[model samples]
Target: MSPSQPEVVAARPLTGPRESQDQEGAIPPATTRPEQRAQARDIVRLFQCRLCSFPLRDPVTLPCGRSICKQCLPESHLRLHISYPAVPERLQGFQCPFADCGREHAVGDCGLDVVLSKTTELVKDNLARGKAEAARIKMSTRIAVRDEWEIAGIPSLRSPSPTSEILTGGRLVAAWSMAENGQLDFDAEVVYHGMDGESDDGNFAEFEQEALHQVQEVARTEMDCQICYALFFDPLTTPCGHTFCRSCLHRILDHSLYCPICRRKLAMNPLLNRIACPANERLDLIIETFWKEELHARQGILEAEEIGRHESLDVPLFVCTLSFPMVPTFLHIFEPRYRLMIRRAVEGNRMFGMVLPKRAHFSSDREFHELGTLLRIVNVQYYPDGRSLIETMGVSRFRVVEHGMLDGYTIGKTDRIDDISLEEEEALEAREVTPATSPQSEFTTSEHGSPDLATQTQAPLALENQEDIARIPTKQLLEYALDFVARMRANSVPWLTQRMLELYGECPDDPTIFPWWLASMLPVRELEKYKLLETSSVRERLKICCRWIMEWEQSRW
Candidate 1:
């Protein structure tokens, strides 16, 4: 029948005994038997179709763990085909009927639930037998009361009429007299003999216990993660109407962006972090309700794994170019392995390490430099074909202690590297201070009336400049680096473009960060610039920058 035209099973009134009791002017004892029956009927309602409110005909289980009759399943459509032509052409299904569980499902993904079907049949049979037995006992009670009234010489009151009603009222006094003398007590007890059947109660109780056990078993089987072969922990449902543990799905996506069971393409956003992909709330509730202890155990295991991951310092590594702390790095991720790595990083802590590739002649043992910058993902834009452009900012410098390859990408255990504390910097500067000298005095004047950078190193003034730089204050060092950037921009240096300024921002006011910023913008070789990562002293990095600027100016001359 159509869902709107539900076939309701209305409760049948207690006809025989109730009618007889009313005619005999007898007051019946208040019993909870009817209320008990109503409760049992309500429990049976669980087997009814959610759509039609009738006993399930062919139960089908949705990915969200709700069961509905197959006939009640919604119509499938070709919407997925139109939206994503790359996806294989097939009829996609509809959302679950339950309001709390609206996870979309494909027609092919939902199938008949054999266990629920058998359990439904058992419930129907038990309900039918109970109703029939109650009816039989009720009918027998009415017949026995009529026979006892006839034996007591009371006029037959089977038919309701004016005469019968009057005679029944008159016979009520005689009936009570016979009842007090115990003439009607034996028949009354015999009429309710069937109600005390121990065998029937025992059989029904057994059936109920068995049905409950079957339902629990079905729940356990359904809640298990196919990949892990255990109760689902943090379950997530895909658009294809398949549910899997969140971790299992993550591992699956690393290999292929398709549903493992249906082989259907999963629509996923690489930029969407793990928090955005929420677990199946309804399915999680069901799993918890059925397997609370198992779920807790699974959670403990996951927590332990998380703690171990942190203790090991394991992190994904992106080995491509040199990156410095506080600098922004833009990457075009197209390779499959790197794509997977980016997804995992975004989903996880949104952090990964970026290091420059080691030259083939430099090191055959390792492919990348040990010193690298830890990058935190800032933003990500994805293409329809799985390509993505990600923006990340370097958080800190790290040294790879140990490294390995995973799914074609690099992974490493790293320790963070920080510049010396302010106190340490002050002490070093104080110990290394020398007499001050003007920077202009370091260069010799050429015929063009400008400083000749090439001859500056050979002049006596060059040693004075070096001595003054060693004792220079942090503020003065920053000023020198800023002045060098200004000169380069004024000279219209090829690498120092407006875009570069906008990208890295004008040289920072902090002396320690200034060196890394200038070093990143400079056209110096990566290996030469790699020195910045090795040094802990800010003054030392500034010295390296000064040497680079001098070499560039000398080269121009």
Candidate 2:
């Protein structure tokens, strides 16, 4: 070496007892390859709890759209003595711990971020595998170099010649090469010879592909809804840190107000609708980002099911009593089949057809009357024994075109019945009115002078007056029905109680709806009241109501 050049020292490999001492001595600080460390840091940044700075455990997404670990939540923000299956109460203006997100949050508004949670597990597994692989590769390199020297007949304590090359399988395993800086550098490569002649790099690549496939499979399974056992179409997270499909949750709520997984009571809210609950936007975004094709396929399945439901006219039937449009119907559902029907109705559309059961000894293809009303469920309260009290409002009238049995309950295909518009009725009446020159008017005027003739003619004249009464304007008819309802209420009629008023509301001012309201409270045979559903003309319905009221008054007298 020239005096002006820097002296280079050759690195020595440890061996025998010295190597064992090096391994047993003070442990070196844990280290990872640059790329592995970077990957680990990225995962920590993404999924670490903001409060604890550790991998998330039971991740909860707050109302502000940020996620954190549930265990890291401030003690002051949690309700004391909240046991298992019962979610913590609202945080009551709890402030977020994140520096960039100091927004207020309520614990009630938070739910487990199922997709994020699963992703965290995947990332964590990747990190752990990376660390293990790096350590294994490092240890294998040391062992491979020692074995190569031993196979070459080199003593453990002697340094090999700089020019000497150790070979395995005719490939250089350990060697020294000249660097551009006029120094010799030691280079060692470890290769695990396999029966298939595959290089370590190729084996590692295969391992990596298999690991990736496994991770994807796990992710797919994690994204599935527990109830349906399929990929989640519209996922909803409950307050108890459980996730389910929105439709699945609706079905669950219809039968019981508790969560399917944890059995926690689900508080009724506007977000929970008859058909579906509000979807988890965060989890949905995660699913869409990673599994776009699968999610689309799942959504298509749901759409096809919905189409089939509508095309088949698959409506559940409650064969109990007579119901009319714009009227409230209360039901005490106790039978197993009807309870199942209510659950299915609530899960699908919250609607079912209400019909009067066919009279005993009457032979018919259907179990109920053909004319019926469609009732939309407004609220449902479930009991411990699976019984429920459901409040429903009549939506429209329908006539059963076809009917069948389903799960021991009646199902119907029906055509909706709507009343003729007042304009149409008025046009028909105009065309039917008699001209002033008609013989009927002349006969009435000519008989007015004879008392004996008038006496005999009074009955026919009264009938004519009654017919004229039915022809009154809709506004006047509405006024007459309102007056009758008000008078009956003033008299404190048994059926017209305060509770009934609260349920059905005060008599509606609309003429088309007024008749149903009056008839619902009337004490008459349901079969007799079924006439209202059959009538299409509002004027005729009012006439029927007027006659019913007359008979009721006559019976009272």
Model 1 misplaced stretches (Cα beyond 4 Å): 1-307, 310-313, 360-364, 435-468
The TM-score leader among the candidates is: 1
Q: What are the Cα lDDT values of the candidates?
A: 0.58, 0.56
In model 1, what is the error at residue 193, expressed in angstroms? Answer: 90
Off by over 4 Å in 2: 1-313, 360-364, 429-465
Question: Tens digits of per-residue lDDT for model 1 on 1-557?
Answer: 11111111112213233222342433233232333222222333445555665566777766555667789888664322111111222134576677876655556446565545665565455444433553443311110122344335463643222121110101112222233233443223111111222234444344334444444565565667778887778876554556677778765654455778878765333111334345654455445544678889999998998778767647899999998876788899999999999999989989899988875664547888899998889999999999999998877787998888899999999876655533234445545543343333244556744344356442222323445565544435555667778878998988899898888888676664688888778888999999999997777888778777667766852
Q: Cα RMSDs of all predictions?
A: 25.1, 24.6
Per-prediction TM-score, please?
A: 0.41, 0.40
In model 1, residue pairs whose N, Cα or C atoms come closer than 3 Å (at least 3 residues apart or on different chains), thus clashing, are none
The 10-residue segment with the lowest total lDDT in model 2:
170-179
TM-score of 2: 0.40
